[model samples]
Target: MSRIAVVTLVLHFYMAITVSTFANQTGRPNVLVIMVDDLGYGDLASFGAKDMRTPHIDRLMSEGMRFNEFYANCCVCSPTRAALLSGRYPEMVGIPGVVRTQPESNYGYLTPDSVMLPELFQKAGYHTTLIGKWHLGLAKPNRPNQRGFDEFLGFLGDMMDDYWTHLRLGNNYMRRNEEVIDPEGHATDLFTQWSIQSLEKREADGKPFFQYLAYNAPHFPIQPPEDWHERVKAREKNADPARVKNIAFVEHLDDGIGQVLSALDKLGLSENTIVVFTSDNGGKMKYGASNGALRSDKTHVYEGGIKVPTCVRWPGKIRAGQETSFTALTMDILPTLGDLCGVPLETEIEGRSFKPVLLEGKQAAFTEPVFHMWLQNGTKEAMREGDWKLVRDNPGDPFELYNLKNDPFEKVDLANEQPERLERMVRVLMVHMEKAQKIPWKRPEAQANVNH
Candidate 1:
């Protein structure tokens, strides 16, 4: 062949490679974040739950990397949600605890100041939608639309009424943004249906989407469909009547998730879309949630309270049937999605990207120490840095330290023997607290009276 003809062929091959690389880089992947409320670490078969059936969620675990040390920033709902969305510590976000009541204007709520995951995605040419409980804030300036989401369909309070009644903020109504009205079906069913509809709409528009399916199921007011309750009760003969009802509630929730997953498959979105399943915090022990090897339940700093069930699935990209004991946090979700979707982070992100572990099965990338604190009303109630944990009632109280690595359940305390380690942990905790802008503890009026 002539030299010019061979050179032309080589140029075409190089151009093809360049175009293929550019297409791969520009392909915006869809993100589906499925967050369950108050599910414990041991609630799934893959996570070691023996009795209850979470086969669908377990399927996610079998098809994705499951993190054993995954944790919510708070043992409760509001703070954890704030931290997850903002990619910052809860204390930094000014949400000390759950926002149960409609508070004054000065009170903290999810506002425009927060840079939410959906907002980032929307800016990067992705449609953003939410279909489930949004307990962040109910007031005017704190709604999901005001914060980031372009399409919002969920309640705006910390908790809601029964699935049959669907009362939120004193009545049974589903909000299309800030407005509210009664929905035609159960909460779980409605959320799933809306999510599927949104997915379809986005697909038709030829734009990728970031969906936040935040279900309020299995949290409290544990009431399930009668038939589901019957099935659970029949299976666990010795279960408490009320606890059985709770199990049925979770089971029905699982069914709702099944519908969503089924929709993804039917629409052929599963292969391209990333699906993540996780809970806000630990489960209610009194309601019969098995926290596996951990002790205590929601509201405490114990493993059973903070550690939650977590699983992620992305076909063709993330390896299937994998489980790792590496530590992770809810804060990691934002950065992971950001990295995958090519959304350039506007500010510093607290969570590290677990993409390496998910795609390549690399374990060493998750060696960073995840810091944690639960301070309500400006008092450091609990703190965890790496393996050592410390809990205190007040400023005057001595720190109660535990080695979580040795005692995952936090049953033993070695504070007396490990003075050096305790001191080091305390110093590190103080530094983090200061950096995160944690408020100093102010004694309650009753405490002052007692002191006087």
Candidate 2:
């Protein structure tokens, strides 16, 4: 070879190695957590929903590992979200129920000391953004930005009275990083667009981002765009009106998700991004939602209320087209993400990482019994220790026990049949409640003015 050609070949090899080294040093996978509000266990086509069409979500499931027994921290919105972000049980973070606009109706308050998932992402050198719902608080000291998100663009209340209006109890809760702005279009579309924008900006900036896209769709006021509703109605002419609306609503939300996924693919970020899709809780049956074979629905401590459809996708990392029955809770997500991103938890948290289950098909069982609570209206709680479950649907209701391995649907109560087991579980639950009492679910001022 000529001397000039040999020198050029050596230069090209050197540049290639330099570029590879740069990518290796800085290419931490972007984390995108798409959490839908009140999505049912059987809502997606892949999750045994024969009547619904969720192509985008189904495609995601096909390309990822589906979690058969994943659960939210609570049946209600705020508590589950609190657990998800704080990496602790909802009550431990001072959020035992929904956070509402009215102080009288609000059942929980987010403590300032709680360490959020985004805060950890920030410390790990990633740009964090939240686009969609932020139900943890409606005011300062608890807002998304205040809690550690670098950017926040979404609703700040529990649920929107109307999807387009983006209002809750006639008050506008929509915001753009703490600024109240009246954005035109449906909540789902707006959130999707904002999420795409964030992805595009992240691509340009070349910084790994942690984007929590929480959508308040198919929650209540079951409204789908007229055209989408018409499409579903035309397709399912025999379906009930309520059911048609919900199916349409969810399908539209799925399309929005598809758009975000497409943006990731288009920007060449899909291969280096970890996408987690899940819901805050089970669907509300009254609103025409399905939880498959699970018993009861939202607001109750049954399989249907807390069991959510969850999946995670990471190309070349987590194997695709996989399914696992390894039970996990929403709080576990923070530690899982920290594990994936090489970020260490700065403080102690109750969440246990399921990184092993994701990467390998290992059983990442919980050492502690899993607990679920919802304090609104009346306290309802459930505890899962291994295959056995203990449930109390209301304050005065008798505790019901079921061996989930034998009765996945909670069809037969074994509380009386297994007295010793029931007593042992009840004792454990009471101890948990005793410790949680010190957390103070209500705000200090609210507690002080009890007479008022």
Candidate 3:
């Protein structure tokens, strides 16, 4: 056991006393969700990362369960993050693409009607805070504090141009709640430090807390601290220099994760805190990000675009050191958390909780067809039913089919050979689109404007 873990065990008695002093739920688990941007499915040691070392994340995997076939709802950032919080398809919540500062370049907006995960946690007696990236909205109506979180200390808009500058398109998006902050540090370190500070505060307050610690690292402008890049270059001598920067960027993020996890232990919350780690989507191909032989890259509807590394850890309460082939989606996180923490599911949600799969190793019972759609490059959309996938990459083009079980890399096109399967999945896509048409994916002014 780690020294922090040892200290946590010794501090359990004090934590119990702390809990007794507050109006806390009897056994509700505190939640810590760590999400990184543009991290690929194979970017961590626990998820087949070859060039990078992610020991802190690997420890979480070894101490809990690593998901084999987990997926992000969208191939981009804002859509997937919105889906994870809303327990619905990204489009259903009015976020079908990346939310940008420039309305002309932006593709999505968070619907005002959506009831978010943080709100549910707050109502369930947990103090809620968002510690990092908040790409959902830039305006007041959709800001983090307005969206449901009690404490919002993070970036307000999309990707940061310079991690240290915390600017996107030369506009500052970093904030401490409603007040803008000009923090001096890398994006990953600042988010991690804010998380530690939040943990320290919540631990002292004796209330169960829900932390959505999102990091904007390894996204674009692959900027690693000079020393971290040098460390990677020295260790992986044969690796490409550009790729070494990506490796070092992710390694530094992993180091932040290590400190965050250590803080949980030192705060005496590790044993009961449920940790969920994942990424918004796959890495950008133009960057030195490796998708582990998966096809295409971020912004495309390939396995490489939507599939991502995901894991869960809750000491003693969860099965450790195992892997599951559950077809989990980012959307399922909200409902799964609702189930796991015994919070009431009052809102209508498209997500089906896989809580049983976590506790009992039960196979995921979600039978609905999964959709991954992106409208930025073209009218790109894909639907999955079991192992079969149908993708329509562009308008005026016929849909293509592939049996993922037989062709995981999407090397073979079965559109002609499996006409029946193609037709069936096409129908599935149409049905989802029909429902999507009812929900506006952009602001009313922008909703009428389609990219293509």
lDDT of 2 by residue, 1-452 (tens): 99999999999999988975686577788999999999999888999899988888998888989999999998878899998898999999889898888888888888768888999999889999999998888777889998889999989888889998888888998899979999999999999999999999999999899999999997998999999999999999999899999999999999999999999999988988999999999999999899988998888889999999999999888899999999999999999999998987987899999999899979657879988988876789999999999999889889999999989999999999999999999999999987887787776688888637
lDDT of 2 at 427: 97
Span of ten consecutive residues with least summed lDDT in model 1: 438-447
- Cα lDDT for residue 106, candidate 2: 89
Sorted on TM-score, highest at the top, how do the candidates line up? Answer: 2, 3, 1
Clashing pairs in 2: none
Model 3, 391-419: lDDT tens per residue?
87666588988889889999899999988
Q: State the local distance difference test value for candidate 3.
A: 0.87
Which lDDT value does model 1 have at 378? 52
Q: Which candidate is the best by TM-score?
A: 2
**Tens-digit lDDT string for candidate 1 (108-127):** 44434567777788889888
Candidate 1: regions farther than 4 A off = 1-26, 102-107, 169-173, 363-369, 378-380, 393-397, 435-452
TM-score of 2: 0.95
Give the clashing pairs for model 3. Answer: none
The better candidate by TM-score, 1 or 3, is 3
